[model samples]
Target: MRMRAAILFEQGRPRPYAASRPLQVEEVALEGPGRGEVLIEVAAAGLCHSDLSAIEGIRPRPLPVVIGHEGAGIVRECGQGVTDLRPGDHVVTVFVSSCGTCRYCVRGRPNICPSGFAARAAGTLLSGARRIRRLNGEAVNHGSGLSLFAQYAVVARRAMVRIDPDVPLEDAAIFGCAVMTGAGAVLNTARLEAGEAIAIVGLGGVGMNALFAALAAGAERIVAVDANAEKLGLARQWGATDTFLATEPDCAGKVRAATDGGLDTVIETAGTIRAMELAHAITARGGRTVSAGLPASDAAFSYLHAQLVSDEKSILGSYMGSCVPERDIPRFLGLYRRGRLPVERLKSGFLGLDAINEGFDRLAEGGVLRQILRPNA
Candidate 1:
């Protein structure tokens, strides 16, 4: 099959992607779903900071890859050995296509399944096969085992969750990454209880979702912090009880002072060392500081060992919010249906495949949240 897709041939392109154009909109050849795989007509794919990180070479992905990790689509075809799902089913893609027999999957920690991680790093489907090629037969790599930046995607059956047709696809797309990672940070990793005081540092799409989750969980004091004043304002409008500008000096100290020596949990979602530093600083003694951000692969953060020991503060790293996609995606969507999650508000707007580069430019500017790409539209 022929389809329109955005292909990233190179990384670390300078800013103003409208000109650098890290991702080239091109027509590519796609293959049918293999055994144990499913073909999907992509409905909506979200532009995320992690995608930007790839564009900026903050994280290295195989070149000439179709780069999109989060999306929702309608299943078009199911390959051999697939019995549960069929054509016309609405589903959301999962990056980690966990092998059920893997130790992590057996332990209910599918988020860290080594099989899924190895496959993504190698830019192949879970079956270890390359399913896309250029018009000239040049093999192309799959991004996150779900190259959803195109009109259609072929992925392992385990990499998707069937959703109700009533759930809007455009809204459901963000659940693949942002909602799962952010909501899981506080609700799953931190296990924040009702009436507990917590703070979300960095109000991007993920951070904003973390805020919403905290609010729905009955957090007594929800402090929202970000370097952008505009984002801070939006956080207040959403549900944050207190908003702080991270750019301000002594920001952490002020938050601690206001919260009577800091919040019970401070979650860092901004994927920056600066944000991680502040998140640790604002955690109360014996409280936990959680980071769900994806910074550069080699980026390192240092903390005073004595302070950690003396305060008895625990620092946790949460990947994909430590989520088991099958169980948590629907749980959060239920919250959205009940009017609690409200992630639809985070949609900045929509774009076509041609504008994907400029979309990243806008996303890099840090003003926009989740920008949807209607690949077939």
Candidate 2:
């Protein structure tokens, strides 16, 4: 099948992406799903910072890739040996395609499954196959095992989870990445307790979801930190106890003071070294700091060695929010259905596939939260 899709062939193109045109929408060929895989007609996909990182060269992947990891769709066909899902079933994509026998999968930590890691590094499906091609017959790389920027995708069975048909695909799309990562960091990774003081740095889609999760978890004080005042305002609207602009000269000091001499936990989702530092600075003694962001491959940060030992502080890296998608996605959706999660509040707007480049522009300017794409529109 041939479908219209967004393809990233180069990185670090000058911003005003609409002008420089970083991602081109072209007619591409998609092959049928292989064994243990499924064919999906993409319903909606979200513009996430991780996708932007690839465009900015912060997180490099093989060129000529379809770059979308957060998406939801309907299964159009099933490959051999796939009996659980069938045509017309709604499902959400998971970036990590864990091989059930890998050590990480056996231990209930599939987010870092070794096979999934290698497949992502090589830009192929978990089965080590390239299912997309150019009209000229050149193979196109898949992004995170599920390149969902197109009208359709062929992904490993492990890369998708069936969802309740009643849930809107646009709303469920974000759960694949931002919501899962942010909320999971709070509930699973941090295990935040009631009455615990917490702060979330970076008020993007992921950080905002963390803020929502903190409120749901009954955190005593929740501080929202970001450089954009508009985002800070949105955080307050969403129930943040306090909002701090990261641009403030003494932002970390203010966060500590506001939370009565530092918070019990701080979650950093900005994917920047500076935000990580601020998250550390605002954590109370013996507190844990969790980072859900995917920083550049070469990026690094530093902290005082004395603080780690004397304060007994701990820093933890959270991938996919340390989530087991099959377990967590349903649980999170239950929260959404009960009106506790309110994940829909994160959406800024929707666009067709043709406007994807402009959507990235809005994302780069920090003006939109989550822009949904209607690839079939």
| Per-residue lDDT of model 2, residues 219-307, tens digit only | 98898899999999999998998889999999999888777778879999999999999999999999998999888999888889987
Error of 1 at 256 (Å): 1.3
lDDT of candidate 1 over 167-248, digit per residue (tens):
9999999999999999999889999999999999988999999999999899988999999999999999988999889988
Per-structure clash totals for the candidates: 0, 0
Candidate 1 local Cα displacement, residue 328, angstroms: 0.9
Worst 10 residues of 1 by lDDT: 95-104
RMSD of 2: 0.8
- How accurate locally, in lDDT, is each candidate? 0.93, 0.93
Per-candidate TM equals: 0.99, 0.99
In lDDT terms, how accurate is model 2? 0.93
